[model samples]
Every structure is written in C-alpha cells, then in structure tokens.
Target: MTVFLRLSAAAVTAVASCQAVGALAQEVEPSDRATTDRLEEIVVTAARRPTTFQDADVSVTVLSRIQLEQARIRDIRQLDGVVPNVQFNESGQLGSTFISIRGIESNPFIVNRAAVYIDGIPFRELSNAVLNQVESIEVLRGPQATLYGANSESGLIVINTRAPTDHAVYEGRFTTTGFQGGTSAMIDGFAAGPLSETVSGSLAFKASTSDSFLRNIQPGRPAGEIRENFLQGRLRWKPSDALTINATAYVLDTNAPGVFDQEYLPLDVDLYNRTYAETYNGGRTIGQFTYVNDAPKKTEELETVAGLSATYQLAYGTLDAAVSYRKLSTDARGLDVELTALPTSAGQDYKVKTFWNGELRFASPADRPFNYIVGVSHYRQDDRRFLATFVGPGELDDFVPAPVQLAEARDWGAFFSANWTPTALPALTISGGLRYDRAHRSADQTAGSLDLGPAGIFVYRDASLSGDFDAVLPRASALYRVSSQFSLYANAAKGYVPGGFNLTAAQADLADQVLRYDSETLWSREAGFKWRSSNGRFRLAGAAFYIRADHWQEIQVATDEEGRLISSDYIGTDASIDSKGFEIEATAEPIDRLTLTANLGYTDARYRNLQLDADTNVSGERVKLVPEYDGYLAARYQASNGLYVRAEAALTGEESLESRGEAIQPATQTIGLQLGYEGPRWSARLFVDNLTNVRRSSGLAFRNFAFGNDGNWYAPIARSRQVGFELGVRL
Candidate 1:
C-alpha cells in the first residue's frame, strides 16, 4: 500500500511537470518547435476489433517498430523491464518461459495464467524466436477472458508479424555480441515481393549460435552451448476489394549441449562446502554462474506452426475466419538433482503431436452509434510424454524409465460484445461483453517401476482419468471523453483457468485425493485516464486496478508418513490472493531533436486464507516472484546528420522466491546505451547493455531437504555486461 501511494504521487507530479513544460513550449516561436510535433496515433486489435488507443477502454501498451528497435527488444525475455507489471522467468531453456502478470504466476510444469497470440496462433508456452520480424507487440493488462477465453486470468499478449509487401523488397541484418564468458554471431534476412496480380509473399529466417555464459567448473566437463535456427513464410491474397486470404508457416529448431535448463545451488555456502565441496568440486566453493555436474547434458527441440485466415466484406458487416496448427517435440537429458558429480540425473521426452484451433467472427461497422462483434472458437491438443530418473549410476541406459503418459484436451467458446452511445450523452460510451466456454480433458498413464540394487524396487500403477470444466465470463466498461485531448474510463471483467487431472500421482490411495484440481477464477476492476497536450507534444496514461482470485492452484510435492518423497502434482487449496496496483506511462518531446519516455508500476499482492499444508499457514505473505515495483526511463537524441544516441535505465524491486519468504532477491538497476547512424539504404549501431555489471538471478526455485540435501535453491542468473555491433542493409 505504501509503495502504491508513493508511485501514485510521483505519477501525478510527473504529469503536472510535463503539462507545464508543454505550455511553455507553446510560447516559443513556430520555427523553434521540435521536428516531430505530434505523437502518432496507434490502433490496436486487442478487443477483437480495430480501435484507437485513446478511445479503447482497456489498459494496453503498444510497442511500435521504432520503439522495439530503440529498446533492443529482440526476444520475449528482454521485455521484462520495458513492459509494466510483467515479468518473464527464463529457465535457461529453449522453449520453457514462465510469465507473470499483475502478480499471477506461471511455471514450467503448469499452464500459463496469461495467454499469448502470435500471428493468430495461440501459444500457452511461448518461444523466444517468435518475436523475430514482428510488426508490433500489444500487451493488455487485466482479465481478458471475455474475448480470449480460458488461461487469460492475468492478461494477454498479441504479436503481429510484418505482412507481405506489394512491391519487391529485401533486407538483411548481421550482429556480433561479446559478453563476459562467450561471443556469438547472428544473421537475419527478409525478402518479400508480389507473387502475382492478386497475391504477395514474404519469407524471413534467423540463425545463431553461442556459448552459454554459465560455465561448468567440473573436471573434463564441457561448457554449455546453444544453436538455433528459425524460418517463416507468409502469403497474402487479395482476390477482390471485398475479399482477402492469408497463410503463414514457420519452423524453429534448437540444440543445446552441456546445458541443464535448471541448476540447483546451496542456500548456505558454508554448509555446502563442508558437505560436498571436497568430494564433488575439488574443495572449491560453489559460486554464481558455475556448477559441477558429471552427467551428460543435452536438449533438442523442434516446433512447427501453420495458419490460414480469410476475411470477407458483408453488406452491413465484415466476416473473418482463421485456423491454425502447431506441433512441438522435445528430447532432454542431463538434469542433476543433487547439483553434484554423484551420477544422479533425470531425462524427459515429450511431443505435442496434434494441436489445432479455429475461430470465426463478425464485426459491424465502427462508424455507427451502435456496434457489435460476435465470435466462436474451438481448440484441441494431443500429447505423449516419457520420463526417467536415475539415482545412483549409469544414466538412462541402465535405469528403468517411467510409463508413457498420453493426454488429450478440447475447448469451445462463444462470445458477444457490443458498444452503445446514448443520444442524450454523446460523450459517454458504454461497452459490455459475455462469453461461454467449456473444456474437456482426458489422460492415460501406463504402469512402470525402477530397481535400485541395494535400495528397493519402486512400482507404479496404471490410471485413466477424464473430466469436464466450464465457465461463463463477462465484462463491462464505460468511457467518458472529457475533450479531444483527455478521457476517463473504468472497467470490470472475469477470468478463469479450467480444471485438470493430475496423472503423475503414483499411489492409488493418493490418486483419490489428488487426482483432480478445480478451476481458478479472478475478478478485476480498473479505472484510468489518458491525456494529451493540445499541441500534441506530450502524452500520459495512468491506471489503478484491484484483483481478487479464488481457488489458487499450487504444485505440491507429496511425501510419505516417514518424510520420504513420493510424487508431485497440482493441487487446489482453500486459499485466495488479492492484488492492487497502479501504472503510469508518459512520452514527451520536450525539446527539438529529443524524446523522453518513462513508466512506473507498483503491485501489492498478498495471500489471504491460505494454507500450504496441514502444518503451514502463509496468510498475508507476498506472492512469490512478484516484484513490488518496477520502472523504466529513457532519452533519445537525433541529429540532423542521421546520427542518434539513446540512454536507458531499468529498475526492479525486491521479491520473494517462495511462498514462505525464506529466500528474497534484492533490487537491481541496469543501464544501457546505443549509438547508431541511419542512411537511406543502410544502418549501423553500437550498443552496450548492463553497463554497471549488475549480477542477479532472473528466477529462483525452492527445493529444500530433497535429494538428500540440506537446502537446495535453483536459479537462472542474469547475463553479465554485453557489447554488440549491428549492421543492416535494404535494397
């Protein structure tokens, strides 16, 4: 609460200061004005319809192409500081990214709380390479289930790739980066042209390889390394002025050697040294970004996506239809549970063989007093997985692997949204939406066992589970246009995540109690204002939101009566969480040839009526992995000679790593600088990131007293300082 108040006060002061400066600028002569006088108007499709940013009632942030380039945001993980009230937890893997929005968290083992859409294809688990060649990125904060359906209890992210050009165009970019521990190079190319009188096509590709910054300190062990390749093609056909069709296909492949996605460390350095340093690490202290593991490490992944869409102009409205298919396969090994050279490891193989979705929608003309949109969507997926755990010796070859797990899921939804303006109140607009969604899930697990020479034989039981879940989501909002330069809005919405069965449970008796978990629901209320100067030199937007969630789902590591580890699965608890936050964003051209931008966010999220287990009650505890406050500031200057310089800083507040607040990550601040020159057909840039060499962990996992360790805390540390040069050419 204190943080929120402080942020609110600061935002108000900043807005007032900017307004005063704008007024003063008007007193100057016309010739002394900035080169770019007015801010560009941005249109977004977050509500399933095109609407101006100032007119839309939702709280959204849009990153334009220029902004993306200035911020050097090439991957999703790089957006952590630039986007307000959002964080990307990097697990140091190719496709394992966890996102947190407004204090709602997602992990690798569970479905995402927020949903992401890339070129009309839904992604529950996002990949870093998907951000390449994007036209714009839109982030909508709050419950978006009314239009996006399930798994959007937190928010939504929409990414639109650049479309095919009507005229021939070619572009290429090359970059080389040098960091503390390694060097890497990447090349990106794009080509587009007209395929025929009514058709155009575009293709883009990216290839990169690098040595991991995290080193392996053990003897004769190889250091981590990564190689990635991506390719995408897009086709657009305009049969007539009233009809259009589009198709897209993409593939991504990655290979990582000697890299364990997640690495465990000791909470107490002294205890760790006394326990295993002499025997495992040659009597050396375990430090950050260094580990000792003798197991063979490798991870391979392949992903493919294809999508098609069509739009037709109707007499009174427009109709749109889209279908998409996606598949992902992963094979991984070399996960050392003990963080030692003791030969205890794990491996997994999983394939999402069939995943597809389709949607149809109609939108009425937006130039009328009353407009509406109606849509229906269907989604389905099937997957198979195999897991192995090796305890004492030789890896997968000598161990008995776990059973093959098969799962299937299906979902369907229908939604309607409308906006109305009363004749008596022309300045006030009211909007409302409703959606009905249903989901079905089924899973089957085959029995298996593990044999430990002197220990014992562990046996697994076969199980089959099926279930159905449903929800009715609704939203309402009102916007009042005070004038052409200012507006105020308020909205409320509901969001939910469907229930699912836990097939990992081993014991039949435990299955009855932990076989299924209930759905989680959230209600959010938000109010905000947007303002722009009459001269259009400054813009500011601020919002305050409150959210309440019920039936929080958490992963529980089950243990036997004697404190022996049994299994882990998702479980619903009699707990809830309340989050309150505020965000402020502003942009201004205070003087000629210069631009300034700043944003700040604060979230006060805490648990209520919470119980982790029979013996632990964590009421009033702050949510894990949620920062209390985050902020960004940047300034850029452009000279008449086409040379530009930009400086930026990002700040992140302290956060707890676990629900019990046993481990806390301190606050961190980083600085970045860029100098570039742009010409008619060429560009070059020199950039430096993390100028102060700040070292911290991007994410943390708490695992205590497991795998015969006193305290095991796993983390993925942030990269050190980096210097890079980039060159680009267009023809």
Candidate 2:
C-alpha cells in the first residue's frame, strides 16, 4: 500500500510539473512557434506486420535509434527502469540472465517466460540479451503466443540491427570508465558501403577489458577480471525491384578469471557485519565488495549466430522466409558448497551444438479494409552438459563427475491472424488470431557415482525420458478511434510454454513423478488508451492488465519419501499465480528543444495454489523477484549550439527473494546525469551512473542446510558508482 501511494504521488507531481511548463510555453510569442518541433511518428513491426504506434491494438514501448544513443543503453539490464513493469536479474555470469515482466518471473533452470528476438534469430535460454549497432527496440506486453508461439507468456522484445546502406558510411567510438575499484576501456567501430549494383555489406565490432570492482581480501588471491569481444556482419542483395535478401552473422566471446560470479553473505545485517569483521576483513565491517576464497575460479564462453531472410512482393500479398542457426558453449570452475576459504570446488561444461529454426509467412496489403497474415515455423535444439564437484586439497583437479546429460527438442507451429474494419462502423477495428503448436522433447543420462570422504558414496541413476505436448492459443483485440489524435484498445490472449522431461532427477522410485512436468499456460486481458495533442508536442499512453497462470513450472529440490536429500534437482508443475498491474508512460516537449519523459508501473502478483513441499502451502504469498512498483523520470535539454544536458531517476519497490517471503529487498532509487556535445563530424559525452553509490543485491539464492548453509544467502552485488567519458567520430 505504501509503495502504491508513493508511486501515485510521484505521478501527480510529474503531471503538475509538465502542466506548468506547458502553461509557461503558452505565453511565448506567436513567431516563436516556428522553432518548435512535432513529435516523430513511430512505426512498429511487433505484430508480424507494420503498424503505427497509435493504430496497434496492443501495449508496447518503442525506443528509436536516437533515444538509444541519448540514454546510453548498450545492454539489456540497462532497460529495467526505462521499460515499465520489466526487470532484469543479473547473476554476473555471462550465460545467466533472468527476467521478470508484469510479475511473471523466469529463473536460470527454466526456459524464459519472455521471448527475445535479435534480427531474425530467437533466444529462449537464460542468456545475456546484448544490444549492438541496433536501430530500434520494441517491447510488447502480454501473451504473444498467437504470433510468436510458446515461451512468450509474459511478453516479447524485438531488436532490429542497422541494415546495410546503399551509400558508404563509417563510425568509430572510444570510451573509458572509472568505478570504485577499477577502470575499463572499450572500442567500437562500424563500416558499411555498396559492394556492387545489387549488393551491400556492413560490419560492426566491439572490444573491452575491465578489472573487477569487487576486491579479494584473501592473501595472494586475485579479484575477478573480464575481457570481451563482439563482431557482427551483414549483407543485403536487391536483385530486382520486387525481391530482397539479407544475411547476418554475429559472434561473442567472454573470459573471466579469479572469482566466481556469486558470493555468500549473512542475511541478518548484524550477523553480516560481525562475520565480515571477524572472518574476512580483519575487524572491519566494510566488506560488501570484498570476499575470501581459496579455490581457483575461471569462466569462458563463446556464442555464434547466423541467419538468412528473404522478402518478395507478390500479386496476392508479400511473402517472407527466414532461417537461423545458433551455438553456445561454456566452461566454468568455481567454489562448490562453501563460501569461505575451504578446499571445495565445482566445474561446469556445457554445449548447445545444434540450434536451428525457420519460418515462412505471407501478409495481405495493409490498405485493404480487411487484411490477414498466415505463417508457419519450426525449431530444433540439441544440448549436452557435464558437471563435477571436488573436495580436499586437490580442489578442482581431482573431482567426482555427475551424470552426462543429453537433451533434444523439436517444435512446429502454424498461425493465422486477420483484421476487419467494416464500412458500417468505420471508426472501429477488430482483430483475432489463433495458432496450433506441437512439441516433442527427449533426454538421456549416463550413470555416474560420487565419493565423499567419510560421507559415503552417492550413485546417480541412469534414465531415459520423453514427452510430447501440444497447445492451441488464441487472441483477440478491438480498437476504437475516438478522434484523429486519440484511441482506445482492449485485448485478450493466451500463451504457453511447452512441457519437458527432467534429466537430472536421480531417484529411481520417484522417476515417474519427477521426470516429466506439464506445460505452463497463461491468459491475459488488458485495456489501454493512447492520446496526443494537436501539434504532437505531447503524448500519453496507459494500460491496465490482469493475468492468470496455470501449471507454472519451477525448479525444486529432489527428496526421498522420508524427506531426505537426493542427488539432483527436478522441475515441478504444482503452482498457479494471479497477477494484476497498470502502467503509464508520457512524453512531452513543453518547450522547444527540451524533452521530458515519465513512466510508472504497479503490480500485485501472488501465488494462488502452490505447495513447496508436503509441509508447506503458500496460497497467498507474494511472487518472488517481482517488485511492487517501478518507475523512471527523465529530462533532457538540447541547446541550439550543440550542447545538451540530461538528468534521470529510477525507482524500484520492495521485492521478495524467496517463495515463503523470508528474504526481502527494500525499495531503492537511483539517479544519473549526462553532459554532451553533438556536432556534424564529432560527438563527446561525460556521464555518471548510480550517482548515490547505492549498494544492493541484484539477485539471491538460498543454500541447502546440508550443504554448508551457515544461516546465510548467496547473491551478486549490484555495481557501484561509475563515471565515464565517450568520444565518437563519423566519416
């Protein structure tokens, strides 16, 4: 309740401020109006078709190239506050990134509830959604199953990279950043030009190196350090006026050394202070960015993606076809169960060797009174993983390997959607879509054993499992044009995630119960309005939504009948959730060359029917990782002499870190400032992030009591204050 009140007050204050600015602008001379600029019209392709922002009957947020540059948003985590009701949980690892949208949460063990698309390739894993040389980003909220199929229950994010240009262009940038404990440097370059009369090509690359902000307190131990490189290339061919083809490829490599991505700390503040003072920091309590570990740690990852797409103009409609391939491999070694300087370590090696997908679609002319689209898609993936644990002085060199797990999946879907604008009711438009999806998954495990001194030997059971799941999703929407500058829309949709087998469950007797989990489904309903002034100097959009989820999948501990710990974890489907939320976004140009933007979101999400175990029933507890409220407010002023200043604030409400609400994260507010100069041939900027030096955990996990819990929790601390300068040149 308090969070909601604070959000309401902030909203009111922002509105009043904007109104005062508008009133002040009204007193300007009539001749000064010529200097004012109208808001630019934005066109989006989130619905598998092109539509203006006001004409689309869905809740969405669009960021253009200029906005991305001004905000200095280079990655996905930076979008948390800019987009309403969205949060990114960073674990410090390159491959693990969990996302929460509108109270629907995703973790490292399960598939993402929200889907992400870069270029024409899809990503369903919990991986970093990096942005590079991107032209625009579109965030569409609600269930998008009718068009995107499964794994889009919460929402969808679409990223379109800058395409090859017909004329020659070149750009380069260099950056240096200083933080609490270290400094980093980065370089980026892009080049594009015409190769021939019918072909054009482009290349973009970035490289960076940074020292870890977190210091190691242990003697002779080093802090975590990182090095990264990225490259992308594109080719476009226009053989004829009616046909076009595009091919793109990208690669990312990351390496980290010294410390693991996470650390353990006592949950109680007093205990934390005492423990750090006595054990790690030599009687000092200032150890939030310091840790002690004896075992060697390192992580290496490589990912590659390639795609091809073609479009042809036809007599009946436009035809489009696309295909993509992706591969990700990683090897990491770090501490196992103990957070202190104990001789315990763990290792993980995984490879996604084969991931391929393809799609074909056709759409009718948009000018027609009645238009439609039809499409079909297929996806396949094969993965293999290996894990090991080590104890004693040997650490990671001498270890016990777990079962070798191999998994494969295949999916197929067909969908259709249409819009109707009857002549009798020209002011209203109705649209509907439906899709049928089928998925098959299988897994295999090789037997293995682990030997722990004095604790007895543990055996992993050999298993083979398979499952088939199917779903029919549907969606509908209606939009009413109240006036040329105002509209109202309502939408209802169903989304789902396909079922799969759990290859890691090791208990023989509980195989049937733990080996397979059912698919998860959600139904969402939303209503929203969009409005703009006559001169387009002001724009406002708002939406209210409700969602119900069934068969929600979760990663749970595997235990025997007597409640004894088992060898592995399993996926379970024994919970449901109810979520309701509302979001508001406004953009105003109160005066010439000055822009103001504000967005606020509130969500009330709770478990409906959930059983963590035989002894616990959490029916009304708040959902984990979902904040009660979040918002962003920013102001930017650009002078005619090429100088600009921007100031922004981000607000996040409290959140529960555990299912039973044992761990809570308090609300926080952060501020940022930027000063820059833009010229025809050169640009420069100086910026400060997290100006208040706020220290907090971005994510948290509980340790099992049997595996050295020590009444503490594990988490990754958020970044500290950072100041940076960037210089760029265009040729």
Candidate 3:
C-alpha cells in the first residue's frame, strides 16, 4: 500500500509540473503525429501474418526505434521498469536470464517460460537477445501456443531488424558512460544502399570495452573487465515482381567477468555492496573468514548466426520461406564459494550449442473479407558441455575431470489460423487458430566427481535417456469495433513448454528416478480495449488477464540419509499456479509541443497447491520474482526549432524471492533525464540514468552453509548511477 502511495504521489507531481510548464509556453503549430503515433502505427507479425497493432486482439507492447532511443534501452537488462508486468533476473551468465510475465516464472539455469524470435528465427536461449541494429520489438503478454508452440507458455518476444532499402543512407552513434566504479564506451553505426538495380545491402557494427566495476581486494590480481564486438550484414535481391530474397549473417564476441562477490564488502570500501552484518534473520558479519576475491578471471563467448528468407507473391496468396543456423560457444573460469568459506579452487565450464531451423508459410490476401494463414516449422538443436575443477590453496593439487554432457533435440509443428468478418456486421471479427507440435529429445551424460569427506573418494558415472512428446494447442479471440476510434477485444489461448530428458541424472546414484520431467501447460483469458483520437493526440490501451497453469517444473534441494546435500534441477510435476493482472497505458498531448505518457500495472500471482516434500505442503505462496504493482511515467517536449527534453520515472513493488516465502525483495524506484538537440544531419544528447542511485537486488539465493558469520544470502548487485552523452550523425 505504501509503495502504491509513493508512486501515485510521484506521478501526480510530474504531471502537475508538466502542466505548469506548458501553461506558460507560446503557441506553436501542432507537432507531427508520426513521432507520437508510433505505437498505433506499428504492424506486428506475431500471428504469422502482418496485422496492425489496433487490429491484433492479443495484449502486447511495442517499442519503436524512436522510443528505444528516448528510453536509452540498449539491452534486455535495461528493459526493467520500462514495461508492465515484465521483470527479469539477469545473472550476467551466458544463457542464464530468468524472465517472468504476469507471474509465470522459470528458473534461469534450467529453462525459460517465454520464447524469443529474431527475424522469425527462434532462439532456444536468451544469449542472442542483445540489442543492436534492430528496428522494432514486440512483446506478446499472453499465451501464443497456436503459432509459437513450446516455450510460449508465458508469451513471446519478436524482434525485427531493419531491411535493406534502395535509398542510400549511413548512420552512426557514439556514447560514453561514467560512474564511481568504472567507465565504458561504445561505437555503433550502419550503412545501407543499393548495390545494383535489383540488389541492395546493409551492414552494421558495434564495439565496446569497459573497465572492471569491482575493486579487487587481492593484490596483483586485475579487476573485472568487459570487451565485446558485434557485426552483421544483410543482402536483398528482387529477382522479379513476384519474388524477393534476403540473406543475413552476424558475428558476436564478448569477454566478461565471471562469478561475482564472495561476500558483501563494507560500505566505505564499496558503496554498491550491502550487508546484513547486524541483522537478526541470520547471524552473519562482514569480517568473517571469507573475503573479497576479484581476480583476473573472465568468461569468453562467441556466437554466429546466418539466415535466408524468401517471399513469393502468388496469384491467390503470399508464400514465405526461411532457414537459419546459429552456433554458440562459451568458456568460463571462476571460484567456487558455494560450499566452504575458503576457496575450493577454480572451476571451468566449456560449452557449445548449435541450432538449425526452417519455416514455410502461406497467407491469403488481407483485403478479402475472410483471411487465413497456414504454416509449418522445424527446428533441431545440439549441445555439448565440458567442466573441470582444480582444488588447492597455494598450488593446484587435486583435479576433477568431468565427462561431457550432451543433448540433442528436434521439434516440428504445423499451425493454421483464420479471421472471419460477417458481411452484415463488418465491425465484428472472429479469429481462431490451432497448432500441433511433436518433439523428440535425447540426452547423453557422463559425470565424474571428487569426494572430500574422510578419505578422497573419486566417482565416475554414465547415463543415457530419451523421450518423445506431442501436444495440440488452440486459440480464439473476438474483436468488436465500437467506432472508428475505439475497439474492444477478448481472447482465450493455451500454450506449453515441451518435456525433455534431464542430463544431470547421470551424476546421481538413482538415474531413473530423475531421468525426465513432463511438460508444463498454461491457459489464459484476457479482455482489452484500444482507443485513439482522430488527430492522434491521445491514445490509451488497457487489458485485464487471468492465467491458470498446471504441472509446473521446479527444482528441489534436499539432503540424503548421510547428510549429503543433493539438488535436482528439474523434478517437480503436478503443482499448479494462478495469476491475474491488469495493465493500462495512456499517452496525451496536453500541448502541441509536449507529450505525457503513463502506464500502470497490477499483478497478483500465487501458487495454488504445491508439495515440496512428503511432510511439507506449501500453498498460496507468492510466485518468485513477480511484483504486485509496477508502473512508469514519462514526459517529452519538443520545440519547432529542433530542441527537446525528456524525463521519466519507474516504480516496482515488493516481491517474494522464494516459493516458500523465506526471502523478500523491497520495492525500488528509478528515474531518468535526457536533453538533446537535433539538426538536419547531426544530433546530440546528454542523459542521466538511475538519478538517485538506488541499490536494489534483482534476485536472491541461498549460500552453501547452513548458518555462519558469513551471510547465507546470495544477491547480485546491479549497476549504479550513470551519466553519459551520445552523438549521432546521418548521411
């Protein structure tokens, strides 16, 4: 309640201030609706067909190129507080990002509830969601299984890159950010033009490096640093008036620091690090046996993606076909502080993932009273992982060589959807879709470990497991056009995450007990409305949604008879969860030169019935990482002389970190400010993010020990306040 009050007050103050400033401004010509109407103008392809935002019955959020710049959203992590009912726990590890939508949450290290698509290519992992050379991002907030299939239980995010054009254009941008701990710089640019009468091409590049944000307490060891390079190219060919082809390729390389913060540092030493030194929840202090160890360690990553797409304009319909291939390799080394206060030694993990996918789709003409689309997609992914651990204090003595863990998966699906409008009442439209998915997965694992109780006991194990599953999902929606400017929509959808074999079962004594986990399923019902003014000066969108999920897959940690701790990454089934939320987004132009936008979201997510073990039944606990209330408010003003300024603020409500309600995270608030000037060919902007430097933990976990002076709480610190300037030029 208090968090809501604070947010209300902040929003009221901002609105009042903007109104006061607008009352004294001189009258000017009405501004271009193009800039502010970007949301209504956006056309999305989530349904395998091009549909205007207003016509799409699903709940979605669209961010255009102009909006991305105004918000300074560079990566997925920065998307926090910018959207409604959307949150993330970014562990900064390769392929480890937990995303939640309306309380549907998944483990970061195990699987994701939502799927991500780049230019119509599905990515099994979140490592490729990086923001660069992009055009637009569309986030569907409800079940989309009819078209997307698995991993769409929560929803899906579709990112479309800019296509090559016949017109010649070149654009470049440079930015540098400075803070108390470190500084970073980046250069991004792109060039697009026609190579021949029937051919066009575009190229984009980005390079950046940053000093370590952590101060190494260990002598002679370097601080954590980051370096990255990204490059992509696209070529398009128009063979005839009926056919078009495009090919794209990209390469990404990044090196970053591994495992962070052994223990919280003192306030004087690190302003960002917080501690529970004198708390009563756990008996812990900063001056324990464990100390900071910011050594010169890093995780190297490389990713390459290539794709080809062709569209043929048939006499009766349009045919689209695409194929893509992606490869990812990562090598990491870090200290293992999970078990003991003293360093157990260094640990390393090397992994490689390869993915191949193809899609074919045909859509009827949109101008007809009845429209339909039919599509089929096939994808296969293979992974190989190798791990190593070196143990010792001063010198490396004991060495554990882990066997390779391998997994191969293949999925194929076919979907058909149609839209019908009655001739008598053209304002009423009915839509429905159905999809059938079949998946085959297999795992090969060989695990090796070193025991360290009384006498050193080494163990080696091997296991193989395979599984096959099939699902049929459906979707239905209705839209009523009340008027030219207002529309009401209601939809019901179902989605699921496919089942797979557990590779970790090889390490334990009982392999069959944990060989595989079943798929989780979700059903959602939502109602929403869209409204806009004739002049595009005002826009409002809101939605109310309810979701029921079954067979939630969860990891459980328990102890064996010998007091040996064991963790099963994917074990749970038959548990249930329920979530309901409401979101409202509105934008108004109080004056011709000023635009004010505000969004409010409320979510109540809780587990229905869950059995942690034979003796414990935890029901009605809040879902992990889903906040009750989240919202943002912003104001932007532009002058006829090409001058502009903007300010925005976001508020996040309190949330529980664990399913058992053992840990909780407090509410957080952040603000941003920007000032800029634009000319014909040049533009410059100065921006400040996290203006108040709020320190809040995005996630929480348990330490290795039961209880001790060292706090048993594991929380990753987020970035602090940053101020920077960006310059851009176009030719």
**Clash statistics: count for each candidate:** 0, 0, 0
Q: Give the CA lDDT, 0 to 100, for residue 168 in model 2.
A: 68
Residue pairs in steric clash, candidate 3? none
Using lDDT as the measure, the top candidate is 2
List runs of model 2 lying over 4 Å from the truth: 1-37, 259-270, 276-286, 395-400, 450-458, 505-511, 558-567, 704-709
Decide which is better by lDDT, 2 or 3: 2
Ranking by lDDT: 2, 1, 3
lDDT of 1 at 39: 64
- For each candidate, the alpha-carbon lDDT, in order, equals 0.77, 0.77, 0.71
| lDDT score, candidate 3, position 230 | 92
Angstrom error at residue 442, model 2: 0.8
**After best superposition, candidate 1 residue 330: deviation in angstroms?**
1.0
lDDT of 3 at 466: 87
Q: Which stretches of candidate 3 lie over 4 Å from their true place?
A: 1-40, 93-95, 214-216, 257-291, 294-296, 339-341, 394-399, 450-460, 505-511, 559-565, 705-711
141-258: candidate 1 lDDT, tens digit per residue:
9888878878778999998887898776666677778777777677676667788999999998877777777777666667778778899999999999999999999999988887
Each prediction's TM-score versus the true structure? 0.91, 0.91, 0.88
